[model samples]
Target: MTRTVFFISDSTGITAETLGSSLLSQFEQQKFEHVIVPYVDSIEKAQAAVEKIDRVAKESGEQPIIFDTLVNADIRAVIATSSGFIIDVLAHFLGQLETALGQKPSSTVGRVKNADRDARYKNRIDAVNFALDNDDGARINRYDQAQVILIGVSRSGKTPTCLYLALQTGVFVANYPLTEEDLEERRLPRPLAEYRDRLYGLTIEPERLSAIRSERRPNSPYASLRRCEDEVRDAEALFSRFGIPYIDTTHASVEEIATRILVETGLRGQRSQ
Candidate 1:
C-alpha cells in the first residue's frame, strides 16, 4: 500500500524531507507518495497546507504522514488541525535544547541567512568557479591556489569529482586531463610537479573507459579497446611511479570519490566555514 507523506517547512523543505526520508527508509515494505510544501511561514500558507493534507487524506482514505519543521507557533498550530499523523520535528528537540542552553530558540526562518552563512556561501561559489576555470588543465598557473588537483585520462570521472568537492565541501579543486603526450612520457605535467603532494589520480577499467569514449567518438581508434587498455595501464603505472594516491573510478559515484579523497588526504576537517 502507498501512503501519502507530507514534508512541510517554513523555508526550503530540505530538512524535513531529509529527516522524513531517512525515517521512511527503515520501512522496507512500505511505499510513499511524497508531497513537499515549502515556504509555509504565514498563517494563510499553513492553513492552505492543512487543507491540502486533509484533502489527500479524504481521497486516499488513510491519514497522511506529516513531517514538519515549522518554526512559527501560530503556523504550527494551524497545521496541527489537519487530518494527518503529525510529526513535529523542531518541537521534539527545541524544548530539550532550550532547557540545556537556558535560552529560548531563535525560531527564525531560513536559519542559514546570516552574514557568516552568506560569507560561507560566497566561498563555495568561488570554489565552484575555480573548479570550472581550472578544468582539464585550462588555467595551469593557478595550481598554486588549489587545495587538491585531480589527474586522469578523459572521461575517468575527474571533472565531476572536482566539481563535487568544490560545491559540496567548498574545497578549491582543480582537474588536469592527461593527454596522449603525458601518458606516453609517463611523467606528471610540468605545471603539476610542484604540487605533487596535493595530486590525486583516477583510473578506470579499460572496458568501461572504452564504452564511455565510444559514446562520444564512436568507432574511432581513440575509443578502441586496445587504446583504452594502453592508456589505463600507463596512467596507473605513472601514478605508482610518482607515489600519488589514486583510485579506480570504475564503479564509484562522484560523492564516494570526493569522500574517499578527503578521508585519505585528511582534508575532511578543512572544509570552508
Candidate 2:
C-alpha cells in the first residue's frame, strides 16, 4: 500500500525531508508520496498544514506520517492535533540533549540565523567555485589548492562526485578526465604526477559507462561499448600501475564515492578551518 509522508519545517524543510526519507528507507517494501512544507512558523501556516494533513488522512482512509522540525511549541501543538502520526523531529532529540547537557536550547526557529554570515557557508561556496574552476583537468597550476583530485575515464562519475564532496563537506575537490591519449599511453600526466599523494581514481563497469556516454553522445564512437571497455581497462591498469587508490563507481552514489574519497585521502572539511 502507498502512504503519504509530510516533512514540515520552520525553514527550508531540508532537515525533515532528509531525516524522514532516511528513516523511510528502512521499509524497503513500502511506497510513499512525499510532501515538503516549509516556513510554517506562524499559527496560520500551522493550521493550514493541519488542514492539508487532515484532508489527506480522510481521503486515503489512513493517517499520513509527519516529520516536523518546527521548534515553536504552539506550532508543534497545532501540528500534533492533526490526524497524521506526527513526529516532532527536533523536540524529541533536543529534549533529550538538553537533559544530558544540562542546558536549555535557544528554542528559536531554524534558519532564523543568517547562514550567509557563517564561515562554513562561505567555505562551501568557495569549494564549489574551486570545483568549477578546476573541472575536467582545467588549470593544472591550481592542483596545489585541491584537497583531493579525482582522475577517471569520461562518464565514470568523476565530475559530479567532486562537486558533491566540495559542496557538502567543504572539501576542495578537482576532477580530471582520462582521455583517449592518456589511456593509450598508460602514464600519468606530468601535472597529475606531481600530486600523486592527493590523487584518487574512479572506474566504472564497461556496460554502465557505455550507457552513460550514450546519453551524452548517441551513435558515436565515443559512446561505443568497445571504446568504453578499452578506456576502463586501461584506466584501471594505470591506477594499479601507479598505486593510486581507486573505487568502482558502477553501483555507487556520488555521496558514497565522495565519502570514500574523503575517508581514504584523510581530507578534512575546509569549512572547519
Candidate 3:
C-alpha cells in the first residue's frame, strides 16, 4: 500500500525537517509515498495541506497518515479532518516536561545565549546529523554525497576518520574495510570496483599497522607483524598499480587526513569550484 505522511511543526521546525528527511529516505524500502509540509506556521498553509491530503485521499480512496506536530491545539484541529494520524509530538513531550518541572518552559533562548557557544553547538549538531544521513555505503553512487570515505584495513582508523569528518566538516562519510581476501586477489571488492573512479585508499607503515592490529587481536596470526606487513604491502601495491590514490593514515588527525584526501583526490576543490 502506498502511504502518505504529512509533517507539521513549529519552533523545532529544523528538527522536524531532519526527521522528515530520514523518514522519507526510507520510502524506497517501505514502498510508501510521503510528503513533508513544514512550518504549518499559519492556519492557511495547514488548511491547504489538509485540503490536498483530502483531495488525494478521496480520489485514491486511501487514507493517508498525517504526522502533525502543531504546538498549538487550534492549528492541530484545523488539520485534523483530513489527517489519518494526527500526532502532537512536541506537546506530548513538553507536557511531560511541564509535569516534571511543575512549570512551562520559557520560550527565551536562554539555554543557548552565548553566540559563540550557540554556533559551536549548532555545528556539532550539524556534523552528527550529517554522519547519520551520509553513511559510507550510501556514498557509493553519490560522490557528491560524501564528505570523505575512510578507506583502510580493519582497525586502521576508518571508523574514527568517518566520525571525525562528520563531527568536524559536517560531511557525510562512509568507511569500508579492505579484507585479506581482497588483498590476496590484489583487487578491490567487485562492488567497490564499480566505484573505483571515486575510490580513495588509506594505508599505514607496516610496523604501525602491526602494532594497532596487535592491540585488537593479540597473539593471533591476523595481527602478526609479518601478516600485517604483507597485507599493507599488497594493498598499497595494488592501489598504486591501479592508479587509485591513497593516504597514509599513520600520525594524522581525522581533520588532517580527510582534508588531505579531499585535496589530493581533487574531490573538494572540484565540488566547490
RMSD of candidate 1 to the truth, in angstroms, is 3.4
Q: Candidate 2 lDDT, tens digit per residue, 17-108? A: 87898899999999999999999989999999999999999999988999999888888989989999988788779989999999988878
True lDDT of residue 81, candidate 1: 96
Best of the candidates, lDDT:
1
lDDT tens digits, residue span 1-273, model 3 = 666665666443545544555556665665566576766767787688788888878877877766655666566778887746665555667778999999976533213347765666566566666555544444455545554555567767777766765565445566667778878887777657655666678888888988887888888998898988888888888888778788888887776787877677665321110
The worst-scoring run of ten residues by lDDT in candidate 2 lies at 110-119
List TM-score per model, in order.
0.79, 0.92, 0.48
lDDT of 1 by residue, 55-138 (tens): 999999999999999888888889989999999888879999999999999888767648877777788899999999999999
- The per-residue C-alpha lDDT of model 2 at residue 190 equals 81
Q: Mark the 10 consecutive residues where model 1 has the least summed lDDT.
A: 264-273
Reference-based lDDT, each prediction: 0.90, 0.89, 0.67
Among the numbered candidates, top TM-score falls to: 2
Please tell me which model should have the higher lDDT, number 1 or number 3: 1
In model 3, the clashing pairs are 136-174
Where in model 1 is the C-alpha error above 4 Å?
A: 1-6, 19-36, 50-66, 81-96, 268-273
